[model samples]
Target: MTDDTLAEGKAADREKWKEKGVALRAFFYIFGTHVFAGFVWLLFYLGGHAQK
Candidate 1:
């Protein structure tokens, strides 16, 4: 409850929210999954046409 302890807690919270994994982690996670899924679908479509 002291001022020093409160200041430390705020600093920790700031560090947590500012972490890079909070941004780029979500970016790559969704981006890579969607891109891979689209690429697979494209290949499937191309292959299906080639068989015809």
Candidate 2:
């Protein structure tokens, strides 16, 4: 293949990855929030039990 063709292919791949990256970032953000919330709940639960 020619250099121009290779460059075009690379550019296309980059665009595709950019789109996928946005979705992946959003998924991580949501997953992290849930994990953090669960951790907080666990701490609270342990604290309450310890008091008793």
Number of the top lDDT candidate:
2
Clashes per candidate, residues 3 or more apart or on different chains: 0, 0
Per-residue CA lDDT of model 1 for 1-52, tens digit only, reads 9999999999998998888667988899999999999999999999989955
Q: What stretches of model 1 exceed 4 Å from their correct place?
A: 1-10, 13-20
Error of 2 at 18 (Å): 1.7
Give the local distance difference test score of model 2.
0.98
Q: Each model's TM-score, in the order given? A: 0.60, 0.64
TM-score result, candidate 1: 0.60
Clashes of 2: 0
Tell me which residue pairs clash in candidate 1. none
